[model samples]
Target: MRTIHAPRLLLLLGTSLVVRFGQTLRSEDRERGDVPGWVMITLMSATLVAFILVMAQGALESMFNAAMEKVNP
Candidate 1:
């Protein structure tokens, strides 16, 4: 009786701990901590790309056309 009860008690405790840990993880996931970081990175990358294109539109077009001609022909 004691052995059976002890195993069952430990299993119940372990199950409760696992449930609590899972709840903590879920709550943490609801917070968008890194979303702003990602947004900033995306905006900065887009701005950089726009700046580069504005500065070198002709050069990039010529490079792209040359590469395509080499690949297809």
Candidate 2:
């Protein structure tokens, strides 16, 4: 009997599940909203932060330092 390693077994199982899920989604082909919205929210938030950092970097840094000082001291 051939033995499969643990990592290899997990990879195989993950791939099988992904393929099965893809097949199920294809068969349904309607109301596809199986998305983790956090992804988009995170991207949007990062973009907003970048804009804020560019616009008010000094103000933001000062605010952060003040907050940290209050927390620490």
The most accurate candidate by TM-score is 1
- State every prediction's TM-score relative to the real structure: 0.45, 0.39
Worst 10 residues of 1 by lDDT: 1-10
> After superposing candidate 1, which stretches have Cα over 4 Å from the reference?
1-32, 71-73
- Residues 21-46 of candidate 2: C-alpha lDDT, one tens digit per residue: 55656765556565534444454455
Give the Cα-based TM-score of candidate 2 against the true structure: 0.39
Per-residue lDDT for 7-36 in model 1, tens only?
455455545555654555566466767655
Q: What lDDT score goes with residue 13 in model 2?
A: 56
Count of clashes, each model: 0, 0
